[model samples]
Target: MGEIKYKRILLKLSGEALMGKQNFGIDGDVVKFIASEVKEAYEMGVQIGIVVGGGNIFRGVSESAKGMDRVSADYMGMLATVINSLALQNALENLGVPTRVQTAIEMRQVAEPFIRRRAIRHLEKGRVVIFGAGTGNPYFTTDTAATLRASEINADVVLKATKVDGVYDADPVKYKDAVKFDAITYLEVLNKGLKVMDSTAISMCMDNEIPIIVFDLFGKGNLKNILLGKKIGTLVEGKHD
Candidate 1:
């Protein structure tokens, strides 16, 4: 295999990825598989930072907000991310990869609070830092948090592990003939209104010139392939003026 292209990357994983085929909650088998992939990448000498979403446990914004306040619902979503982060930390550590969970909300009893310098130090020491609590703010998706952390940590690339193999012209699952692009500019993504990620996240990444590779994490060797700089996913890059 060729040498990995990037030295450090920020991996963005959705909470639903941990659910496997189950209706809800984290699935041990799936978590183990995901952990193994991370281990594989680490063995290839890639520095990894993970940001996990909380949709599996709670989606405060989408749930009935008739009585609940929007901000309160969003806070609940942030807590759900912490739950997923702890679960992932356990899984990664079991595989002998040192890991840390840093939350935006201070819950030192469970995990360390978000500290930029500390996080960078951890990454420098080759420990995977999983960021949780979604920017410690409401009305912001974990996608945005991933972009923010990726920029703060100076990651070379942002690897978004999603359900699909890559970004398509339309929903691949629903539209059988949707065309998948090998690479695209951020401007095209925004112009087309592609749902690879929320606009806020895309804009953040574009502004920072952080390349994002969107690939299917469910597929075997997908994450490892991306780390190896193999042509296995859709890459969105900054637009050239």
Candidate 2:
């Protein structure tokens, strides 16, 4: 119940995270659990924006790019994100949390089109705005979209909810002795080439001076802990000492 350090935050959730233990697609129970967790933060008066990936349903670059245009494949991936966003919006509303799904690609019948001013207004009204469609451009990952939206929304931080608790020197899943960092600078992340996020996303955040906290969302209370300014994850920021 500590004071929330961030008035508004952009949360980046990987589509794979929504799958839980399932091989693909979203797991209903898992989405519900995440929705509940988001509700906890929302009730505490913290404005939340979400950017979700579509790896669970499709990875266009890897799947349909056999002979098709790369840009077209990427657009398909963006559409997949919109599907995920709608699903999450449904889940959050079922939990009684006010939510909005805004897509870069306008689908008026389903959700709002991405509008920075409108999104900010929604946040001021205490509604959670979910951003989908990955910047509405091809060759951009959801990570970059999260960073871009975080900057546009003037969020205090980008909370990257991942499977691992923090960034590591090597792949923790494969490297048993990988060292986890409690805190790090943007330069360190870039220099070491740690896969905490794509370089484009990291650079965008660094340039905007937006701090990113990498933490495991599956751990109960981790998001709450981070919002309360407790040290629960690896924080990457600009020009750290």
Candidate 3:
């Protein structure tokens, strides 16, 4: 209804977010809820792209993968993202929101392989493109894949959907007196060891001059509010936001 600030956005959804109140795995209701939220933005004529993590199902860097081969564990983790992506696609499609699932790992039976031009075309055609399988390689987190895809797709900003509202001096849940910053530079986030995103992802964003907004997407209409230019999140950029 208001002016749209970010025309195209890359939403990074942690797999744990899809699990809802459960310990792991996809929760259908939560996926539908998220899909509904995304549908709001899509209806507003915003181009959407998503990069989903595999933490809920399996994290390659987690303790569960300590004894396994690092590469093998990472591949499994990538596959887990594909599962989440497919779930999201199904949810979005059920809502009558056109969507596509593209994986870095070529599993043509389930999804299309990642092709930059094709992805842009999908976005241009008013379809939400969900990118899965974390760069299709080992040793890289989905966070990095998100920034990389955002760069390739030329998204206006990277919307990082986390549990917290924004970046705080300390864990807001643990410290009642923690301070929150409305805007912060990328270097400050890395220098202070803030967990807004992984260093590789932050660095890529910094290098590419892409702004990253860390926000609590669980809040109703938070994602759409951001697109509509409401400042309700922490903006991480190369300079002042």
Candidate 4:
């Protein structure tokens, strides 16, 4: 295997990535594809932790949350993440990869409660640990949860899997001349108000000294390629332009 920039990493996947062509919920094919990509990385001796969002199932902070209590809507979103986590766990296991699902919200029947040491142990044992439920608190995005976990687990980096290939100056879909950065710094991300991740998430990662790679998850081999140290996405770090 080629040298990997990060020996251990946290992968952040949005719920929409699991939708594939479907309008809502998980798509079996997309899950399988993601599982395959993760498996390839696991085979490279890279320890992996994954955080999945619930936007595809239901976004608590979105327009659908109208008329609902903010806390209530966020709790519902957390549950949706658990559902996605379980689906992903099933897919990875089906492909013969040992995986564990840990949730911030206690649901012992389905998954173990999130414990930092236990999660690290799972990674040491060559198992993929999937974190769900968004920090067990309302008003926090899964992106924050992922960054927090990465810091706790001492992950070398956080791999943000998005539909877009990299962080752009503007929404590529909306602007034909959007500029993509080959690399950027956390301060720039904040100063320029780049939508790489939520401000809270980016700040946490910056404070913890963890770099982030934003890439297109749907692209074939993108995950594995990034793990292998290929420049397949935009790198956001503490320093450099």
Candidate with best lDDT: 3
Candidate 4 stretches with Cα past 4 Å from truth are none
lDDT of each: 0.91, 0.92, 0.96, 0.95
Sorted on lDDT, highest at the top, how do the candidates line up? 3, 4, 2, 1
Better of 1 and 4 by TM-score: 4
- Per-residue lDDT tens digits for candidate 2, residues 106-150, read 889998999999999999999999999999998889999999999
Q: Looking at candidate 2, what is the lDDT of residue 190? A: 91
Evaluated at residue 148, the lDDT of candidate 4 is 94
Error of 4 at 236 (Å): 0.4
Q: Report the lDDT tens digits of candidate 3 across residue range 197-228.
A: 89999999999999999999799999989999
> Mind giving the per-residue lDDT tens digits that candidate 1 earns over 72-113?
999998999999999999999999999999999999999999
**Tens digit of per-residue lDDT, candidate 4, span 57-118:** 99888899999999999999999999999999999999999999999999999999999999
Clashing pairs in 1: none
TM-score of each: 0.96, 0.97, 0.98, 0.98
TM-score (C-alpha) between model 3 and the true structure: 0.98
Regions of candidate 1 where Cα sits further than 4 Å from its true position: 64-66, 239-241
Q: lDDT of candidate 3 vs native?
A: 0.96
How large an RMSD does model 2 have? 1.1
